[model samples]
Target: MANENTDEGLKRVVGVSGLALSIVNGVIGSGIFVLPAIVGIAMGAFGVFGYIACSIILAAIMLCYAEIGSRVTTSGGSYAYVEAAFGNFFGFVINWLFTFGWGILGSAAVMNILADSLAILFPGFANPLIRGFLFFVLIGFMVLINILGTKQGIGLVKLITVIKLLPLLAIIIFGFSQVKTGNLHWEHAPSLKTFGDTALILFYAFAGFETSLGVSGEFKNPKRTVPLGICVGGIVVLIVYMLLQIVTQGVLGAEMATFKDAPLAAVAEKIVGPVGATILLITAAVSCFGSVSADVMATPRTLFAAANDGLFPKFLSKVHPKFATPYLAVLTYGTLIFIVSISGGFKQLAILASAAILLVYLAVILATIKLRMKKQDAGEKTFRIPGGLVFPFIGIAAIIWLLTSLSKWEILSTIIFIAIVCIIYLIMKKFQNKKPVETTLETIL
Candidate 1:
């Protein structure tokens, strides 16, 4: 156990397959099952084109993160990138928000799905007290999984990912036979006015691609595996998303767009029967669970990294003596998630989570540009993004474009989140700096 701890702390063990699984599990969640309806409402059939465009944009951003991860293989994702490129304070602030802001939001979204799934099984489970109890129970389950060990948590994610993808793949295949050509109406063309709105919705679907980078330090050959895994995993997800969307739209026409919940299940019911709808609901529940599992595994790593760097409370820095995990941070995150899940509805929390993640994406792109200029001799990055400076530049621009498309309320909420993070960063920094400096003269006695 001690040897394993040393090796993990020194960057080893994880390989290409682990990295790929992380990326796949992170991105392939309820978003694919749910976001199609949201996007369809915003852009009609043209939303399919918008999803394609956003995939391309996300691919570009993935390349930028690949470059940064290759240069500095570390845990904490955007926090490490920003710190290496700019300085400690800015990076700490970004890391703080990335951990707390999105962590609670993501947890709430996942718990909401769990609660809704319970409501499906028990018709009268919609009571606020019942829902709240289930949410806390789910959070407790995830926290326990994480506290057990990283490998245990990741193994569960791998299993859930396979289970979740099966129904989606089945839907794509079976729904193809039931496709109606008349359903696809291309009367509306993709335009600037609609593009931004659609892109913002699509961004939510592609939000978790960079999650692997948060634990790059765990990878055996991070420089080689991280880049390839991110690229390949993202491309695979893109293909799956596009095919699923195309088949679903063909099967259900525009009716799927108006569903308040379980849009994919509604489409499945139209094509097959009640059995197909039940299968899709199960798939959605599994996907949501898989996402929460990945979140439980990855988010605590960021907190552990920050605490180790003296950017958070010291207790969070302690590793479990037996399990070698960040037990305290995991518990704390789960607790916060349980509290938030009781108040916010699933859709609202989903939007809030996406909004918080977009800010982190903006920071990552900026970090990439800064690193390229600052470390000119950083050597050949394993997966150098095509088009030297243009890709990262365009990636940053794309994130900025999406940010502007969000509503005024979302923008205000994001700003307030950032302000809160900055305050926490300042307090931690002051505490760190105020610690007495021990000198050789004092130690010699």
Candidate 2:
């Protein structure tokens, strides 16, 4: 089939390395740096175990997504997968909420970190207005970098990923040596009552693994690569998170680490002194920056796909003549992030964004089952998930359990976001009633 859009041939050449980098970039963001403190506060010495439990659950969820990605290679991630298995309208609503709602908020959280770090480095620059302006400027810089196209954007992700991991690795190595295991009180087990909150917080840390699925169209061999990347990348992050938590607990103990906002930095100072702490601070900033870059690269593809299908403003689908990239969509998402950054603080947006993505995750798990049954007659299987059908079934069940664990406010906010997206989707459907149907599995693959 001939490519429909003139610029549709602008392929993203992200191989296994780029895919792994994107996953790490997605997982490591602001959450790892700050979330340990919250987890410690809630779960105490047992927070490390909570992290491990969340990692296992996330790995199961990733298995479901890997099945979907193997079956349908597309740019919109869960939206495209669910749409392919379900229907266009349902997919549109899900995609709309995923991209417009959560994507914008996630980007804003990263920008918030950049702004906060800048304020810390130069105390006089802490004015709200100045911080807001600088936040937008930082978003613009990332937008421009992505506008240069996928390879360029991935290159930037690689650089920042390396820079971000250095201090984290240093902390784990040096901080472990300073551990006084007596601080881990065996009696201080995390109560089962707080498991729900721990799961919610852990969700934030693992929320971005789906990002690798977003660029499925760009992978050299998505079936093999996406699953491998998701599994390997997830394990890598799980180890990193675990090590960081262990070092934090061992070095600072549950009490001090739980209280400090910059727990890892505090540990670094104790182990390797002030200079080490400074390096960790810089790493946190770079980690946020790298996540922003990866988000810039991947999320706009959803807008581009939506626009191509007549679900969004058509112009957003237009690729840049020079860069062969979705310039308009990138700017559109960036603008939303800028507004959110100025209007609200990072912590609120981060939690809300995590909630939104969790909703999309539920859809992805169901989509996996639907596609498996729908495509069974097709007799085409490049990669089947281990444990036959049992794994995917358990995965879907786990997601449902997690969904109910969300706080009442998070659930209410998610509903409102979904309703708003449905309203917009209906409006677009009415306007494009006479237009040719544009979304198809073949075109997307």
Candidate 3:
């Protein structure tokens, strides 16, 4: 339970392009492909406004991450930042919430989506046995790729990202020409509750960018790389989301909600007929795989980092002598995803992922404020948010507003999950025979 080893053999080879593409893959996942229809159904033509609002809110949140990520260049992205600002206890809580609560649930949901998407092209994938087999094959491939090396893992992500974007870009380019101006007209503005709910759902599409930073320990010149990569990647995501919404809404019009299951493909079909729909289906599968590939490449580092900090099993921190990767952590995380994906009920739990990620963002934003005030890494140069406390305060308020959109059941579930995490922490602490490190705001600052 001693913090004796920290990033002992992890390579600092990830540069700006690798980091930014990883962020792009992480953010532009299965959610974007289907959320557009839901948003269109909820707010009609005004849904574009919801996308913009979420983008602004996320921009503020990412600014906080940019600052904190630069200041604390460790493996566990959000966990590392909060641990630096606070201490082990809060860090442990965030670790469970971020890594398991959000990461596993979100990725498993994507894996299921991948199976469903593939099933459209090949009906065999619909069978439980075949679907389970597909999950094993895909998950095992990702696990093996990551265990081989970070470079190889990220290389696969890059390939799949390009493959996934082509059909989406094709739809955007062709679908815009087929837009009926009358379809974009609306009679009334959405209510406050409707808009907030729409924005909350859109926020999930942007949530995975933080997971990409989980490999901060393997980043070269993190102070520069983290902020720059986040800025570039964020801009690309905003543009893509805005264009996709405009094209889909403009073409589909009031009937956007009718294709909720495969909205993007509907747009593709409208753009170029049946062939376009087929292409989009393949793209959906590729996009899901790409996102999970990035997740596999990065999120396990949270386990490795936590293990090094003595918060998790020591074996999770072990680096492969040949590959210099956190091989065990990668295997453990991949195994969890496989089990969850094959278990076949994660779609409902996907809501928990949204709630959990909002909490993680809240913690990171708060950590940003505290870390800045305390000047945790005063000796090192780091990116600082332009506004004194304005953005952080805005991020906090925005997160709180989004949390209100959650149903009571989700709220209760998150509370219960946190209680379970706390109990686990206490058990771990007892087993390690170490007293909890008292970490109050006053002491941290």
- Name the candidate that leads on lDDT: 3
After superposing candidate 1 on the true structure, give the runs of residues whose Cα lies further than 4 Å from its correct spot.
1-11, 41-45, 257-261, 343-355, 374-381, 437-445
lDDT of 1 at 73: 73
Q: Rate the local accuracy (lDDT) of all candidates.
A: 0.74, 0.76, 0.87
Ten-residue region with minimum lDDT total, candidate 1: 1-10
TM-scores of all models? Answer: 0.89, 0.90, 0.93
Per-residue lDDT of 126-149 in model 1, one digit per residue for the tens? 898978777777678889987877
User: What are the per-model C-alpha RMSD values against the true structure?
Assistant: 3.3, 5.1, 5.6
Candidate 2 residue lDDT tens string, 242-296: 8887778777775664446888878888877787667777787788888878888
Error of 3 at 363 (Å): 0.9
The sequence of per-residue lDDT tens digits that candidate 3 reaches over residues 1-445 is: 1112334688777778888888888899888888789888999888888888888899999999999998888898999988888899999999999988888988898898899999988999999899989989999999999999887887888788778777878888888898889888889999998887778778877888998999888888888999999999899888888889888889888777678888888888877789888988888888999999999889999999999999999999999988889999999999999998988667766657767888999999999998777734447789999979999999999989878877898899899999999999999888676433434544777
Q: What is the lDDT of residue 250 in candidate 1?
A: 72
Question: Candidate 2: TM-score?
Answer: 0.90
Give me the displacement of residue 65 in model 1, in angstroms: 1.1
TM-score of 1: 0.89
The Cα error of candidate 2 at residue 159, in Å, is 0.9
